[model samples]
Target: MTVRAAWLLPEGQTREDTRLAPVTPMAPESELRSRGGVIAGGDPLKATGAGLMQLRIGTGRAIVQGTDAQGAYPIAVTSPETLTVADGDPQHSRIDSVMLRIYDGLYDTSETTTATVEIVQGAAATTPVAPPLPPASLRLWDVTVPAGVSAGVGGLDWSNALADRRRYTTALGGIIPRGWGLAFDGAHDGQYRDDGAAGLQRWNSAAGAWLPYPYDSGWRPLALTAGYGNPGHGMPAAWRRLGSMVMLRGRIAPTKTGTTIANGATIATLPADIRPAGGKEFAWASPRDQTNKGPSVTRVEINVGGTLRIFESHDLPSWISLDGVTYCTD
Candidate 1:
């Protein structure tokens, strides 16, 4: 983490331009002018005088220090050699248009950019060494706190685990209380306007309430309909009410051992008492419609150990194992 490796020097400064040296603990302690030492009297072009040298240390990353006209060090005076620019030669030209540049290894060679620097004489005390930054750990998501932010809060980016696309449509309908039925439709809530019917509704978790969605013309919100048996029509009491969400908590399936059946094996002839635990294996005959689009189960086979085995049919051209897991096309 110390980024002291790169610096923004004036145009004329090269990697080894030699006007300064690396600031080491052994180097005599020179106070950075309240700003960096600066020389105001001479033309910046002709004078190698110091002022703007942007220093990159660590976290929250930029620093400015330099010398002034009177020379009473405002910014500490350091040997130029200590500053290192990334791609450009330390030997840079002193042209006004030139920018001192230094780059950390964050980018490839194609993106080299010059850094900007400002120098001041005795403008401030020695730049404070920043405290060590906690190493950043990348999680499934990264939250961002915009500028002018306060303590402990940031906007969340949940997209890392969320779907990118969603589709919707419109359905003209009336509200029904929970568990009620519709006149021409089906059973809604039992009472005329009791809760338990169906209509547009939202869950108000804090109040443990189910608020009715506005049905004014042109106003629509996401909705949940009743199961195939019940579709409540306009009974206000039957309006859909929010309820506790049901969460079916379960763990991933337990691991199972698999035995592959070799070619020419048959599984249909196995005894009905065959246990799946043993190494029984078999392959099935390829299906006739054979576009390889349909599923076919292998015949059950019995190994010497009394275990049951079944062949797995796979895609054509490759005959890879489809494994016994059931698949659905809907």
Candidate 2:
């Protein structure tokens, strides 16, 4: 049996490996560019206590780009790496960024191809901004160092001082962690992400934004007004939302079976979020006579204020069907 490694050319081939070389790096690069960040489930450079001026990075793996012109590559911190934080300025506070960097000798002759973590110290000011990252680096976390901060005498506050900047990505276009500057283009349309407090979200190229996924509010019973209630049949007045469209179902009738329905009588009301922008009319099935013998068509109106009313009825309907009522909520 023979085994061939990635980026290996056929025997006796003299051509450069640029074509095949990019294949190996492009997978991670494309993923990182479109959905890259730290891979979940690993410690992935978690910051922990070491000393007042130092932090310990737990073992983890990440994918980061070198630059727009350079391909992305994977970096692993198999063992914990400890880094020292520079002492703060005496008069002004500053922010410092902890970054994971990939150094390629091909790009910079001065440096060898290696992955390492470093701290980029920010300038001191009344309001300090984090320092910009160098080429081919991924920001792990930001530390706020107050003025006069030093080791031993007064340790850095891990709670308020640390800001997590780590985002996450997955293979095969699975759910990734969303952060600022992540692209919402057609290439990533239909992909899902975790937007921190916003919960799960999906990219929509047409709407040009990330919308909440499964955009559904499971079926809820419609709020019936006075003189109206759900019929005794299995079907009951219910409403739900699917994406940008709101749907209604079930049957409604007067609380008293033989009572006549009034023109423009309010039957139920929709929730604010699922209400239609403008008035809509739907044809519904209703009982033709007091005996509930045959079906007849009736007009139902849903107003902008979310009021559901019977618009026109030939005679008193024992019950009205709302099974097919649907309208856009956008």
Question: Which candidate gets the maximum TM-score versus the true structure?
Answer: 2
Q: Tens digits of per-residue lDDT for model 2 on 1-330?
A: 011111222243223323212223222324435334676774567898688788888877666666565556655565688889888899999999998776666775645545568888999999999999887778989999999989856869877888888867666556766653455342457867777775887777777777777776789989899888876875889998988888888988888867767767888888888888877888866555634445666888888998888865455556677888888986
User: Mind giving the per-residue lDDT tens digits that candidate 1 earns over 1-330?
Assistant: 122222333244444422232222111113322211112222111212121222221111112222222121111223231222112112321111111223322332424433322211111113322122111100110112122222223221223211111011111122222321222211222112223344555334453444444311221121111211111222111111113211111111102223223433322222222223443444556563245467654444445553323344553221222233221111
**lDDT, model 2, position 244:** 83
Worst 10 residues of 1 by lDDT: 133-142
Using alpha carbons, what is the TM-score of model 2?
0.62
Per-residue error (Å), model 2, residue 218: 12
Task: Give TM-scores for every candidate, taking all chains together and pairing residue i with residue i.
Answer: 0.12, 0.62
* lDDT score of residue 52 within candidate 2: 78
Pairs of residues at least 3 apart in sequence or in different chains that clash in candidate 2? 32-36, 66-136
Task: State model 1's lDDT.
Answer: 0.24
